[model samples]
Target: MSKEQVVVARKKKKKVKIFPIVNVILFLVISLIIMVPIWKVIVDSFDAKAGYGMNFLPQTFTLGGYSSILSRVALYRPFLISVVVTIAGTFIGLLLATLGAYVLIQWEMPGRNFFAYMLLFTMIFDGGMIPKYLVMKDLHLLNTLWSVILPLSINVYNLVLMRNFFEGVPESLFEAAEIDGCSPMGTFFKIVLPLSKAALASIGLMYAVQFWNDYTNFKIYINKNELFNFQMKLRNMVMDNDIPDEGGIDPNTIANAAVIVAILPFAIIYPFCQKYFVQGVNVGAVKE
Candidate 1:
């Protein structure tokens, strides 16, 4: 190679190394930014002496916060309600997404495009709050868990993702199932579902997280305190200073503990689903 070209190539390699180093530094900074508040919350949750400030570690560490929250019927009841709603909503959401996506993949189905477009249209627009409220009231679902569960379960984005993943599946396998005298439901259960675990896990995780974290629906539709979910309770505790006075523990500590409890389920669940989540997102975004 010419001397100038060799020197230029060396300079380009040096520039490429700088880019990766910059990216690493950038990501580390971003990670630190996100983790700092989380770390503060964790520290404060255990800090009996926790107050209004940035605390890296607890001055007086205690489980008083968790004990106070967990011991209360008010907190636990809402938590149980959240758990039930999350599980039910996730199941129903996955079922609808899978069934709808499977149907959309059937080339010969009548009005397939129409149905797909209708779902897509929802992604673009929604009936305003008054209309939705009236519909829920008419259905007699207001002030009930179903009011929250049913609305969050119908996610068009998840449906579209599942459809994309289904489209990527080999047509030959479906044809083979048909030739073996398998019904549509049989093929879905035996052939399609077995292969779409990644999509299911990813989409199901999304549904679970959505249902678990939802407060607005519960707040708007459910006036009765008994029907409130964990997120709603957490919102009340954090925003409205509604923490029950117990053990003389700091309300800040209890609030932080409640926050941790609210997020704990998903944090424990995500690591196990991480691989499938990544794979599912990639596959669902791309078509063959």
Candidate 2:
């Protein structure tokens, strides 16, 4: 090779080597940005003497923070109630959203445009809180767990997202199923549902997280303390400034423990759905 050709070869090699090094550095910086705050919280939860300042790691490690939060049986009841509500709500919400989306996506359905418009209208405008409260009261759902679950069971945005996914399914599959004498319901369950797991997983996680974090509905409709969700209990604890103990454990420590305890379940559950969740949301990236 000539001198110019040799230099060009060296330039290409240098470019290839530089790209990976730059990528690694960028990735490390982004990872630290995301992980540091979470790590700080984890460490602070374990630190018994975690005062006003945040710590990089546990200073005086102890279970005092956790013990303080857990010692109150009040917190435990709300935790269990929240768990039941989250599971039940997630299931019910996902079912309704999937079914409703499936119905709406059918091009032949009568009044489809009108119904779709109404669903979209709900996304923008809702009956204010008092009207919703009255509706709940009139339905005799007051002070019941169903009050929380039933009122917000179907999210319009999630329904629309699922519809987008359903619309992307090949029309030929539906035609094939119909030729085999499959009913609409059978087609939904056998073909559409089976092929739509990614969309379902993504929407289900969104509903689950919303139900888990919800406190406003419970606060408005539920007066009974026993029916309060975990977030409600945590709010009471934080707002009332009533730390469980006075002897040694600091209030901030207990607060940190409550934060971790509240967050732990979602963190544990997210990993199982992480693989499908990303791909599901990106189902129709390039719409033609």
Candidate 3:
């Protein structure tokens, strides 16, 4: 290369003078703070033989805590219920929210603003729990999987985010699709959705997290232990004072183990959705 070109390349390769030692020290301190509790719980799950003691690391390690909960009827069933409900609820909620948001943006539609207001209104106001229960009872949606899926089938805040996302899409894209003799549904599926994947991805993560963490509706509307969700069961493990009737495992171990299991899936799912969210928002691909 020529001398001028070499100098230019060197100028472009500018480096910052960050202190590597200080950064490493800070990182280690933060990592220890986060990992300590997680490590403690994992150790506690193996602490069945410790015989009533508390410490950061287990003095007596056994898998009894994990085994006992896994073997229980109420416990495992709830885990399954939570998984099924989260998946079903997330998908259905996404479909309804996306479709509704898209249609509300159609200027030609009658009562579009009124419907938008209605949806927005739900974000700020809600009927009391008792009234909601009565309505659910009247609808005969109580105690079924539908009970979990139906009441929270839509969220107004999410609808707004989706509407904003769809509106951010370009008018020319929609116009081009129309010019090509595409129907509304076809244009939406081919052009709008393909470009709006980031918004869809972000909304999907939000819905999944909300549904996965919720147990209140189930507690109020459901009477059967068989229908308990992962969160409700975790609540029991932490709050319920009852020891095992057979007396093999203690309450603390069960509580900690349940806490760990209940949270582990989210720890896995969020980073995945997060990566897509950052990508989608930055590219403006989801915007109209």
- Candidate 3 residue-wise lDDT, 1-288, digit = tens: 999999988887886547997899999999999987787777777676434444766776666666666677767778888889999999999899889988987989999999999877877888888898898899998889888787777788777878877887898898999999999999889987887788888888878888898888888888987788988877876677544632655567766666777888988877878877776555434433
What value of lDDT does candidate 1 attain over all alpha carbons?
0.89
lDDT against the true structure, each candidate: 0.89, 0.87, 0.79
Candidate 2 local lDDT, residue 280: 87
Candidate 1 lDDT over 30-130, as tens digits, reads: 99999999999999999997898998889998999988878877778888898999999999999999999999999999999999999999999999899
Off by over 4 Å in 2: 1-37, 285-288
- Ranking according to lDDT, highest score first: 1, 2, 3
Q: Write the per-residue lDDT of candidate 2 for residues 1-288, one digit (tens) a residue.
A: 999999999998887567889999999999999998787778888887877676887888888888777788878889898889888998999899889999998899999999999999999999899999999999999999999998778799888888888888888898999999999999999998988888888888888888899999999999998899999999998889977674676788888889999998889999999988998888644232
Q: Ten residues in a row with the worst lDDT in model 1?
A: 279-288
* Superior candidate under lDDT, 1 versus 2: 1
Q: Clashing residue pairs, candidate 1? A: none
Superpose all Cα atoms of candidate 2 onto the true structure and report the RMSD in Å to 1 decimal.
3.4
